[model samples]
Target: MKFIYLDNASTSHPKAPGVATAIANFIEQGSYNPDRGQYSGANDTALAILDLRRRLARRFGASSPRQVIFTQNVTMSINLLLKGLFTAGDHIITTSMEHNSVMRPLNEIRAQGIRFQVVGAEKDGSILPDKIEASIDANTKAIVVTAASNVCGTVMPLREIGKIARARDLYYIIDSAQLAGVLPLKLSELEADAICFTGHKSLLGPQGTGGLILSDRLHHCRPLISGGTGSFSHSEELPGALPDRFEAGTQNLPGLIGLAAAEKWLTKQETKILKHELNLATRFISAISEIDQVRLIGRDADYCQVDNPGRIAVISLDFPDRDNADIAAALYDKYRIMTRCGLHCAPRAHKTLGTYPQGTVRFSFGWSNTVSEVEYTVSAIKDLSQR
Candidate 1:
């Protein structure tokens, strides 16, 4: 049987055309130090990096391209923003649907006197703007929420949350790990103070390419890493500007090149990307709902109970009689179908779903997946029920 890769929530595979080619091109023909040289190759390479940055800025609708600072991944970008903004006695407001990426760091920092309040989302995994607003106190310096749940593919109402954050003078940080490709993000309209984006997922970029977009409001946030930024070598501290200030050490030029290509490819297929993913999710939901043993999660689009209504292409099913691990293995061993089974790294979401110990079998779809692939996956699940 051909492999059915359904673990896109982990990372997207079969990257866009030219993604690898871009990486290879960068490594072979375009390799040059972005900084510390006035030679033609170095100048040309730096321009290439800047060009990618500009594209990233445009992708997120960032007001300034320089604000699109690259990092190793979305987690790194989150850490960079969280560590930089949070301080002693500062309280942050976050949603309960957050992955370990947000919770782990907040928990670690909370031990050091940094405080945080996690407002629970509704039963369908949608967080209310009012709930987030209510959690804010005088000491609350920021409100951070996942732009979409990685576990369930539920998008959140970040724009409304951003409004509340702005009204309360709190920094609004969005983890855009799952929404960057499947949904639309107009950073300026959303009032997103910062958006942590990964290139490997929706952007169809290679790994090691991700970034955070800082709004003009955060003029005082500190840098998580202090090193040579090439632009202020005379000083010992990292540069206190966008992009350059946060990006420390040498960048992954090859990854950035791939990222640029991926973003370009995504731009060419913007409408198709969203519609295709949503249609696939709808199909998965429609097909899986018909199965007696599998339970579909989330709400109907017309009756959106969550702030960000309607899930993306990730369909998580609860097989009550079967062990999640065993079911996952059966899919792989018997059908060559790959999927993730467990809490999906977001224990909070599982606890919300009341499936903490027994995580659901996650079938996350992407642009590369076809209708036939979805049909085959559904057929495999149907077959699994008999065994």
Candidate 2:
């Protein structure tokens, strides 16, 4: 039986063309530790990293390539930013729809006397900038929020929130795990101090590839990790530079190469890919809406009609009486449809949506998914709902 993968929110399947080829080439050609040695291979690898940084910087609207700091994933990037930037007496403003990547780190640092307030989201998973502004206090230092909801693909009002942050002189940090590669982001226009991203999700890159694109304001923050960055070895202190200050230890050369390849492929077809995925999501939502037993979570009455530009192709389906995990398993065992069930690492989002304990079955579309596949999945769900 043919298997259908609908778990793009967790990690993108069928990565961008040439991603595997790029990784294979790097390994076959004998990859070297970038910025580690004086050898030609090391120099070339270092240049490749620089080129990737430059391209990513330009794409993300950074003033310089040095502003991009590589990390294992967005979690690490967020931790580095949050832990390094804030301390006792600091206040952080965020939203209920944030993933654990943001929430967990902030929670961990709360012991240091750094306080954070969560701005409640709408029933439809939308976060209002006004609500966020209302929560701001005299001690507010930064506003950290997700670009979009990982569970429902609800696009946050980034521009409005950014404006509030800028007007208040608060650092604006965006977790773009679900937004990067799938949506166009101009950090300069958003007035964002930093945007964290994971390449394994919408970026169509391999696992272990992610980073942070920050403005010059990051210079004020200290290094989260201090070790060999292949630069400023003579000094005991970490290099007070853009990337070197943040990136420590050996880099993931193959993963970075794959990420660069995926990024290149994504840039070439971003518009088309986004349109295709959104269209599929709309079609799926429309079809699913027709089923009497099926209820869509975190969607408004006008969701189907809204021209959701920043929204990705993620959808959550909640069965009032049925077990979500059972439904997901049935879809897999009976229809060969692969989907993610349960809280999806965002218990706060689930709690906001009132689907905390039971959770929901999520079908997240991607660039590789087709309209026919979406229609088929909808049909399968319709069949299961009737039973």
Candidate 3:
């Protein structure tokens, strides 16, 4: 039986048109590493990588292509930034709605005297810029936050927070995993020093493809790993350039190539994709709100009905009298509707939502999901609720 995929917050499915073809073509014909060799194949690979960088730079409104630093995924990019940039006596500010990608690294770096204060989010998962500003102290070095909550889909007030960061002269880094392709983002407008993004999610690229867009201000941040960067190989020390300084080791050529294709596809379909996802989410929320036992989490259903919605299509539901895991399992087993259940690697977000330890079942919609699929999932939920 075919399954309805509603767990796109974890990873996107049916990737962009031509994504598979791009990866397959690269693997089959030209699998050379970029910037490593002088042959024609190597030169071609390097140019393709450069093209991807330029595309991403223009897509995100970065200063230049040199600021686009590729990494394995957003988690790696966040780790590199958190571990490499801050030192002893430096404090950072973040929201309680962050994924483990930010929380875990911050916890690990506490051993090195780097500290962070978490500004609490409202029960609806909304954060206030004033609260963030009030939390900043003399030792505060940066403000790191996710653009939206992966658990509840509540969009943060980034531009407001960015203004606060700018006024305070603090480095602002954003985890754009949940917001990248779903929302139109410009790093300059957000006043962000860096944006960590993952390709396998909203970008609709292959799994191992993700990177960071750094502003000129953060070009001096220390590298997390040092090795051969395919440039300045004669010297034992790592290269001191923009990307080569941060990106070390053999890159994921096929994945990046696939990402380039996905980027091209997104450039054309972004408006339609956003419209569809919003419609599906609004429809699902409207239907589910009618069930008495079923509780819709995050911002009110009305928030999604606007012309420009604040949040993505990630919907989490709480079954007050039913086990969330059991409901998720029943969804897949009986209705062939796949979903994610539990903390979703974001215990802090769950805690903020008052669902910690008993996390909600999340149904995240994506570009390929249809209105019919959402309606069917809602019907299944209604039937399960009655049982």
Candidate 4:
């Protein structure tokens, strides 16, 4: 049976053209470790890594290429920044709509006498900059928030929040796992101290590829992991450089190559792809709203605003009397329609949407999804609602 994949929020399927080919080519070329040797192959590999860094820096509007550091994934990227920057007695302000990537690390650091405050999002998953500012206190050292909600696709007011962070002299960190490729991001304009991203989601790259784009303020923060950086092998301490300071040991060369291919692909079609995905989402939401048994989460008046960024392709539906997991399973087993159900690693977000204990069924569209697929999925949901 032909499958209809709607779980792009978890990880994008059908990655950009040439992603797999790029990975295979890199591996076939004898996978040389970058910056570890002086041979031609190693030098070429190092150049490729540098090229990827520069490409990412330019694409994201960073001041310099040195600001981008590759990590295993966005999780590792966020952890590196969170653990490395904050210490005892530090305070952080974030939103309830954040994914575990932001929440879990903060919880881990709480034991070190660090504290964090969650600025609750509106019922429609929209965060107010004033709410964020109100949460700030003298001890507040940073503001960490997601660019978009993974569960509902509610895009935060990042520019306003960034301005607030700047005026308060606080670090502004953005978890852009859902927004990197689907939205236009100008880190310089956002005034973000650091933004974390993953390659497997909107970036359309292979898994195990992600990184952080940070400002010069990172020079004061410590490295999460320190070891042989290949640059300062002669020294006992970690190299006090931009990328080499955070990146330790050998890196994910093949994955980074795939990411570079994906980035190139995204740069060429960002506008068209985002419009297509958002249009599909709008159609899906309109169709699903007509079903009596379906309750759409975060689809309220605020979400319907023309300028509301919350209207990305991610949509969540709750069945008032039916189990969301059962609905998801039925969609897969009966119709070959794949989706994600439950908390989606964002229990706090579920709590904010009042879907905790029983999460909603999520359909996250991607560049490859079509209007026909959305129609089919809506038909199936409508048919199932009556049963």
Candidate 5:
């Protein structure tokens, strides 16, 4: 039987056309660490890294390439930014739909006298800007939120919330793990202080590659890790620079190079890919909505008809009378359809959506999925529901 992969939200499969080749070429050519050696090969590597940063800056609409700081992944980027920016007695504002990447770090910092308020999102994973605005106050230090929910792919009202943050003079940080590459992002419009993104997910790049785009307005965030940044090695203290201050130790050169190639490939085909994924999601939702046992989570099917209802190609379904995990397993075993079944690491989101203990089965479509695959999956679900 042929297999269908629909878990792009976790990590994209068959990454961009040249991603693997780029990594392979880098390895075959003898990978060199930039800023560490004085040789021409090392200098060339350094320039390549700079070029990637410049590309990312242009893509994300950052003011300068120097403001782009890379980390191992989105989780590390969020931890570094949140921990460095907050201190005792500070307050933060986030949402119930955030992934563990943001919530876990905030939970850890809470022990240090820093407190955060979660503005509850609607049952459909939609958040209101006023609710977030109401949550902010005198002690509020920053507003950190995910651009879209990983569980349901409901896009947040970032522009409105960013406006609120700017009017209040508060820092706005966004976790773009599920947003980047899936949607168009322009930093100037969002008024964000930082956007943390991972290359493995919607970016269609390999793992171990991600970074942050920082605004010039944010200056006081201290370095989370302190070590050799290939700059100011003679000094005992960390270097006081844009990227070197936050980036410590050896970098992921191979992964970064692959990500660069992936970005290049994705830039040309983003619109067509997005349209295809959305159409697949629309077909799946329409078919599954007719089944009595299937309960669609997040946005209703009507939202798909509009030009943009602020949603991605992620769909979650709950078999109220059947075991969600069992359904997922059956789909994989009997039909060769791969999916994720559980709270998806966002327990708070599950609680908000009212699927807490018995989590839903998530089918996140990707650029490569086709209408025939979606129809077959729907047919399988219908057959299983009847049985």
Candidate 6:
């Protein structure tokens, strides 16, 4: 059977051409350790990485590329914030819509005497910025949340929440795991202390290249690991700086190179990419809305002001008459359509939507997903319901 892929939220399918080309070029023709040598090849490599930083800074509206520290993925970056920024006494506020990437670290910190509060979003997966603001107290130190939920694809009220955090003098960290490439942002306007996102999703970059964009406010965030930082070679301590301070050991050279190329491609295609994804998402939900017995989660009436607007092109359809996992399994095994079911590593989010034990079938779209794919997915859903 011909396969249809609709799980971009988990990890994008068939990355952009430059993604693999750059990585392969690094392994084949561009092999040199950046910052380790003064020779031409090493220097060229250094220039490449520096260029990546510059582009990413502008991509996220960061002050400089040095503020962009490369990590394996959003998970590591989020953990870096939880472990290093929050101390035993610091109180942190998060939302029920967070992925395990953010929750696990905070949960561990909670055991170690840190205070962590999870503000709940509305039943439709919408989080009012004020809800997070109201949870803040004298002891609240930082607020960490996802830009848009991974499970339900509901965009949060970041503008209002960011203002609240700024007014209250609290650190605001946004996990843009699902929204990075699909969304546009003025990070400077958000006034975030640190913004964590991965390259694979939305950003249209390869895996193992996502990380954090930290503001100058988090100069005090301790390092989770320390190793050769290229800078300050003579000293045993980590480099007392932004990227170097957070980045330890040799960086992911090829991944960074691919990421740089991906950024260049995305910068030019940002608007087109969003419109394509939005249109596909719109077509998808419209098809699903026409299907009887299909309940779409995170339903919204509007579609503007968000990169992934209308709440969901990443639709979660609950087949109450049938087992969700069985439907998902059949969609893949028989229909050749890939989807995600169960908690999707966000049990807390699933709980918020009341889909925990029997999670809904997730069909997340991407910029490259054609409308025909949406129709195909809808057909499969209709078939499953009929069965």
Model 1 RMSD in angstroms:
2.1
Summarize candidate 4's per-residue lDDT along 156-222 as a digit string, tens digits.
8999999999999999999999989877777889998898989899999999999999898777778
TM-scores, one per candidate: 0.96, 0.97, 0.98, 0.97, 0.98, 0.96
Candidate with more favorable, higher lDDT: 3 or 4: 3
Candidates 4 and 6 compared by TM-score, better number: 4
* Candidate 3, run of 10 with poorest lDDT: 300-309
Can you write out model 5's per-residue Cα lDDT over 14-58, one digit (the tens) per residue? Answer: 799999998999889979899999998899889989999998898
Question: Could you say which candidate leads in TM-score?
Answer: 3
Task: Kindly list the per-residue Cα lDDT of model 6 for residues 1-387, writing each as its tens digit.
Answer: 678888998888877658888889888985899888889999999999888888878878898878888898999988888888776788999899899998888888898889999999888888887778778888899999888888877888777888999999999999988878776665787888877889887777888888888888887888878898778888986678878898888877888888887888888887887777767777777777787777777764355334437364566778777899999999999889999998889898889898878888998887678888878888888888886
Clashing pairs in 6: 181-202, 181-203
Give the poorly placed runs of model 1, Cα more than 4 Å off: 300-309
As for lDDT, the candidate ahead, 1 or 3, is 3
Number of backbone-clashing residue pairs for each candidate, in the order shown: 0, 0, 0, 0, 0, 2
For candidate 3, give the lDDT of residue 200.
92
Give the clashing residue pairs of candidate 3, or none: none
Question: What CA root-mean-square deviation does each model show from the true structure?
Answer: 2.1, 1.4, 0.9, 1.5, 1.2, 1.5
Most accurate candidate by lDDT? 3
